[model samples]
Target: MSNPNLLVLATGGTIAGSADSATRHDYRPGQIGIDDFLARIEELGIPANLTGKQIANIGSENMTPAIWRDLHRAAVTAIGDPVCDGIIITHGTDTVEETAFVLDVTLPTSKPVVLVGAMRPATAVGYDGLRNFANAMRVASDPDAAGRGVLVVMGDRVFAARDIRKNRTRGTDAFAGFPRDAVGLVTPSALDWFGAPWRMDETARFDFSADLPDVPVLFIHAGITPEYVDRLVTTETRGIIVCGVGEGNMPDSVRERLIRLAQGGLRVVRASRLGEGLVDREPEDDANGFVAARALNPAKARILLQLLIAAGISDPAAIQSEFDRR
Candidate 1:
């Protein structure tokens, strides 16, 4: 049997970063090219037939909605190609969760679409990019990986897009699945899965052909004034996600302004500041037109809200239903 034909869309991150000193960690991200990256993977004799394309060679922290639109369009084109059996996205760890979630919610596929990144630069002696790339290809080639939405392969752990989060700044184990555990695990020798592949979000695939509306996230803190909230309530802004204290709470002064905005038909999501946990809707939430972010962090909540608002779905119940499902 022939190996699975994988189409790799490279959006450079630490995996493509390079440094002059192998001992030092300081390096410039996105210095390597797609050909070199794919060649390194082939040197390891990874079990796949590989083809590569460079989408954007920039740091993931610099990831924007425009790059996401192009990435989605390329993936869709690859999905339709008879030669492409699977798709792999080489992204940076800083914003992989956002990118994965965007693809998971907006791009549906029966074929595997795995996202992978590395902590160390490509030039490091302990360079993790090749191993991560190999494992990502493994997941993409695995028959069971199909229909599992978007997957992130990082440091032996494989996370589902809906639950993936970047947990730390500098470490091999930077990624994790919050509230939920990893869907699979991979190594040079073996592959193990905890569950069967399932559809991600079935309601709709959000169109990213145009510019997504600006929906800012406000991370609340002690002494954060209502003046901050007022800045987000502009004619051009669509929605807001407050990374509130405790159970998505803010000072009454700031809360009042958000409530007024929500009551006036603006979208407001109350997402927690913590890494993992649910922010359940309260009676005041329904009364004041707030959407509880459930288990979503502020970053993920912002993306969902942007997609919702861009689609012109403003009904609080309908938006809440999406926050519930997507």
Candidate 2:
């Protein structure tokens, strides 16, 4: 008979932004406080007993792995609370995918963790943050939303974290879920569903107590040099992710250097710079013990590699198996 208790974590983004005028482009993100943001949501009559906190007030571009660890710890503690039925995260669109991906693979709970954000400032005309926030509450309160890992809600579209990427710069429909359709749609009267539901919580192998290892991503281009590879190796970098031109292919010189590093016990992941596609193993990559990132983009591939290394799985074959997941 009681309403679901919701835990909302506001990590400043456009949803909490303030512009002097509705049409003005100049504004400050996270200028609005969490209580003010929730007050408007409550006025819309979203049926939940809301409890929240402002975890951070920076734009998503400034997101760090330290904050990610803090978020995971907060989420774990909140989910373990008997009074909390679900969780929502207000984040900036620029790096929501990365944050969501980290939480999706690290959190142990099946309770819904819905991340929502706006493409426009809260003070802007045609502001969509309130609507998106309300929809996030509905999705979070729904029992069906459980066991789906972390979900990103925006523009009435719902995407699983592992499959989501920010595809537009200014549009309300800024997110795109590649290699998979959105799991649900927020209709005027109901939440419509489609496809089978899957989550990474059951099989996630990670320990975030240790900070994400130093793993830099390299975007391959014409006339690449082996010197870049030499720098990382000499510096004792834990891992490297190469965003190659196509199907995860790098220039001949760079590929040779990557092979050399892999042979020398450095973990290397081959990911695609192109959007939407799997980077499967090539015969040559396998021969050199380089791991293919399969469907993961370069950024997400880097996140996974950090977890893999931190979890103490350094073998190329074992790391490749983790990336091969659907």
Candidate 3:
């Protein structure tokens, strides 16, 4: 069979960085071109036809909803072309999970869209950017990888966009604990295997509006006053996500205010501040009338709320079901 065509969209991060020639240790983002990165892959003898585009040059923290829309549009347009087989996005490690999740929900494509990044900049010794990029390209080109929604490939592990998280700060292996079945690993023989296989649901193609809601997220801390909740509800916030303490538990005062806010027709979701475990409703826990956030973090929960608002899914029951389904 002929080789697959891969489009490498470079959004600036440490992966596309280079050391200051004068100073041996200092590095800057977007210092290297995608062509240069591809040249390294060619030198390593990876078999694929590669093309490059520089979408943006900033840390992932600086990425915005507007950029997400642009990326969605770009991926859609690229995949529509006859020569394009799939796409691999080079992104910053920070906030990469959020970007992957947004694209996974918004972009309506069965073609593989893989996101890859590196913890160490290209200037660092033993940098893994090129290897990660090559792996992502391989995953994107594989026809078996299609219809899995957006994927994140880092350190030879593949995760569904919905479940991956950056657990470590500066380690080469930063991604961990997606669903057991969603994890994709590369064996020493270079064969790809998935613990869980994901297929796109028919409901995955709902219209995604480019406009996003102005939702705010607030974290509930120990001995925290109710004023924080009050201010968020009374202010110009369209929605609110409360990062409640363990297992979606919050202080009594905060819970009371959230219940009142729900009654007032504002959207409120209860998510856990703890990293792991699912958030469920408990009657004795004072969490009545509040929607459970399930496995979503504060940022991701907010994104889901924004997407729901954009898609005109306002009912709390519907929103709760949507979160639970994934």
Report, for every candidate in turn, its global Cα lDDT versus the true structure: 0.86, 0.85, 0.78
Question: Which pairs clash inside model 3?
Answer: 181-196
Per-residue alpha-carbon lDDT of model 3 for 198-291, expressed as tens digits? Answer: 5643234455556787788888887788898776665566678888788777788887777777777778888877767578866642345567
C-alpha lDDT of residue 203 in model 3: 31
Could you give the candidate ranking by lDDT, starting with the highest? 1, 2, 3
Q: How much is 294 displaced in model 1, in angstroms? A: 0.7
lDDT by residue for model 1 (1-326), tens? 89899999999999999999998858889999999888888899867899899999999999988899889999888877888889999999999999998888877667789999999998898889888888888889886787788899999989999899888998798877877879889986678999766773343277653467778898899899999988767998778898988889889999899888888877899989988757889888888899999889899898888888888888888889988875
Per-residue lDDT tens digits for candidate 2, residues 253-307, read: 8888888778888888988888786888988777898989988888899999989
Q: Once superposed on the true structure, which residue ranges of model 3 sit more than 4 Å away at CA?
A: 21-26, 187-189, 200-203, 284-287
Candidate of highest TM-score: 1
Comparing 1 with 3 on lDDT, the higher-scoring candidate is: 1
**Local error of candidate 1 at residue 269 (angstroms):** 0.3
Candidate 3: global Cα-lDDT? 0.78
Every model's Cα RMSD, please? Answer: 1.5, 1.7, 2.5
TM-score of each: 0.97, 0.95, 0.92
Clashes of each: 0, 0, 1
